[model samples]
Target: MEQATLQTPLGMATILGDRNGIRAIRVTDHSEGEDSIPPALAEACGQLREYFNGERTVFDLPLAPEGTDFQQTVWQALLGIPYGKTISYMDLAKQLGDPAAIRAVAAANGKNPLWIVIPCHRVIGSDGSLTGYAGGIHRKKWLLNHESANPQQSLF
Candidate 1:
């Protein structure tokens, strides 16, 4: 699979994938000069740049996230979430027609390989608190705020 590093308002993120589709996009602490945006990853990198620039809300690209059936279902459901909206894990569980699977749903959410594209940051705690985020709570908050804000402020 090909890999590339993109610099966003949140930080430097490494996007991994190939012709199959984007598999993962994770923030890393690597230095700036090492970016390697290949053709397969250029679209993703550009879209992510647009996202940070507040010019995009929905993502339209091939995806190939690796996960279990349940996890894949959860991730697909996450894609249905609107850009500026938020949902509680419990609500997500109920949406799946299994309120008892709240924990399982949350676990699946946590395992999402694609970051902003999957919009896992849109999910929060039942009490409306910003809960756990693989990318860090601050980034989650920033993403939610970015999506919700109007006038499309530039974070770069």
Candidate 2:
């Protein structure tokens, strides 16, 4: 698998994938040395940069995140969430046809590896509050604020 690390405004982010598609995009401590970036990873980095710059809202890159069938299902549902919108965990579970699966859905959501790419940050608490996030609540707030202020616009 190929990998590339970037210093995003939020922090350091690493992209990992191969010819299949992008597998993961996670924030991590800065890694040493400059690794050669694969084409797909390069493209992912560019798009992420555009996203941070507020010049882009929607992403159109191939993704191949690794997870279980259930987790995969939850991740796919997350993608369906429109840009600049937020949904509660209960709402997400209901969308998956199992309102009782809120906890399970939250667990799967927590395991999302694609980070900003999968748009997991769009998920929030049922109380309309920003909750747990692997990238920290501060980053989550930033992402939500960013999206709310810079929603996708039609080219037409």
Candidate 3:
């Protein structure tokens, strides 16, 4: 696996991947030792740059995040959420055919490793409040607002 850290409006963005596919995209406060920019991560970096620049609303990169089957299912559902749209945990669970799975779905959403690519930031609390995000709620809000300001028609 190789990695690269990029500068974004929120902070440093790190992408980890290999020939298999991208494994994760982590946001952090620093990028000291993360400057290598391996060839395998180039496509992901370019897509992310387009996303942050509001030129790309939909991502078309291969993802290989390590997680349980249930987590993978939740993450895939998250990908279905349109850019600039939000969904409650309950809604997501219901879409999964089990409204009682709200907690579980939210847990998996929190564990999403692909950051903006997986779009875990698009999930919000039932009452419309921003909730737990690995990248911080402030960053979540920023991402949501960013997508909102640049809404695109849903292809689904």
Best by lDDT: 1
CA deviation > 4 Å runs, candidate 1: 150-156
lDDT (tens digit, per residue) of candidate 2 on 63-117: 9999999999999999999988999999999999999999999999999999898
Order of the predicted models by lDDT, top scorer first: 1, 3, 2
lDDT of 2 at 110: 96
Best-fitting candidate, measured by TM-score?
Answer: 1
- What TM-score does prediction 3 earn? 0.92
Candidate 3, superposed: residue stretches over 4 Å from native = 31-34, 150-156
Candidate 2 to truth, TM: 0.90
lDDT of each: 0.91, 0.89, 0.90
1 or 2: which has the higher lDDT? 1
Q: Per-candidate TM vs. native? A: 0.93, 0.90, 0.92
Per-candidate count of clashing residue pairs (backbone under 3 Å): 0, 0, 0
Find the 10 residues in a row with the least total lDDT in model 2: 28-37
